[model samples]
Target: MWNEILHRSWLRLEQNYHFNDSQNVLNVLKQAYAESQRAYHTLQHISECLFHFEQVQDLLGDARAVELALWFHDAVYNPKASDNEECSATLFQDLLKDDLSTALLAKISQWIIATKQHLPSSDQDLNLLLDIDLAILGATSKRFIEYQQQIQCEYHWVDSEIYQHKHKQVLTHFFLQQPLYQTTFFQDHFELQAKQNLTLALAGNLK
Candidate 1:
């Protein structure tokens, strides 16, 4: 399934510029997603984002750019690293600079960086990208619990108390945000459940 997505995404890029080493690039991306340290930020996460993107593709200004951004958003994830988004965006540009226009590459880089704050932006495509990246927050109870566990595994080096403290702060920030999701699609489907999930998790009720 992931391979098929990669193939289709590569084909989309091919439309703009011809690249001969797509297979090698795809392999590198696959390896990044398959890294042993990843639990939540794995290929499955990319697939989830793709699934969400398809649901709202018509709303995007540049569907192809948004799709490509999803592929590289977490390409350089490191739980302990503060510059993962920067690094990932750099990698995205490095890999596709030859195949994409400078303007489109900059747009994609902006979309990837927006994931760091998950805040609404003036750009509709960016709003949708952020929404898709965070859709997991509104998943079913079982899946939400699984996501929490996976996150813990990714940050296993942190002491339990410290982790909880930091986690609570993060959840609180989301709760304080006027609307967690910017897109109407996500706002309608996930707004309430997302609040519930975050509240439960922050209150130590989701464990």
Candidate 2:
């Protein structure tokens, strides 16, 4: 199933991107997914985001940059590293070389960095990619809890106190945002549930 999705995605990339070799793209995907800690940042994440983007196709008219950005967002996901986004963005630019426009490449790089900063933004594609990345926050109660557990597991190396503090800050930041979801779909589905989860997590950490 996973390979099927990867193959289909690679096919789409071949059609859309300037790449000629299928094996090279496949190798990059394999390496990145292998290095990711959880299925959250794995090939599954890329496939799922592609599905979400397709679902919101109307919202993403001429959104090739966002699609490319998603492909590399988690490519260099190193929990212990603060510059993963920068590294991933640079790596992608190098890989694309002169195939894509410099302006478009910069936009894609900006979108990837936005995933890490998550600041208020007017960029529709960037917002949509972020919403998809965090769509699980608005998942059903059981799934939401499962996501929390997975995130905690991803930070297993950290002591409980440090983890709790860092986690609390993140939850608090999200809760304090003007709109948890900048997109209509996310607002309709995830805003309330995300706030509830963040509130509970913060309270639990405090206790």
Candidate 3:
């Protein structure tokens, strides 16, 4: 179902440049998400993001482009690597440069790369996309704990103490975000629960 929707988006992205078989492209994406090295950055994450996208998509100026960016934002994932976002953006650029307008491609790439820090953006589309990506932060208690475990599994190679410290720092940083989610929808729906979840994690109670 998700594949079909994403494929349709790809096929109709733009008629300026001829594109190749979109199924093959989607197959590559499935393979990437299914990589053994991943625990959280998987199809499940993408599906969750897509679910969130469907909710507020009507608010976006270029919803399809935002959806495309969401589809490719995590195309490259390495728990130990810092350039995952850049690499993901590059992958999107390489695959669609022939199809999408250069300006649209650039904006999509920027949207994908923006997930790195998940920082606030002046662009409403970007703000919505980022909020969707981080929606797990404000998921229900069971899902939030699962997300923590999934993240831990991804970085399981790291020493326990080091991972613990760094993980705490990561949680704290997010906790300190003046408004964790940039969009009103997410802020209205998830902000309170997200802050509670973050508070618990920072206090070492969520594990």
The top-ranked prediction according to TM-score is 1
Local distance difference test values of all predictions, in order: 0.86, 0.76, 0.87
Clashes of each: 0, 0, 0
What digit string (tens of lDDT, one per residue) describes model 2 on residues 56-133?
Answer: 757885566677777888788777789988988888887776678888788888888888887657877778888987
Clash list (residue pairs), candidate 2: none
How much is 194 displaced in model 1, in angstroms? 0.6
Residue-wise C-alpha lDDT for candidate 1, range 123-199, written one tens digit per residue: 89899999999899898878889998999899999999999888888889987777988989999998899999998
Please give, for residues 158-187, the per-residue lDDT of candidate 3 as tens digits: 999999999999999989998999999999
Candidate 2, after superposition: displacement of residue 172 in Å?
Answer: 1.5
Superposing all C-alpha atoms, what RMSD in Å does each candidate have to the true structure? 1.8, 2.7, 2.4
lDDT preference between candidates 1 and 2, better one: 1
The candidate, 1 or 2, that scores higher on TM-score is: 1
The candidate that wins on lDDT is: 3
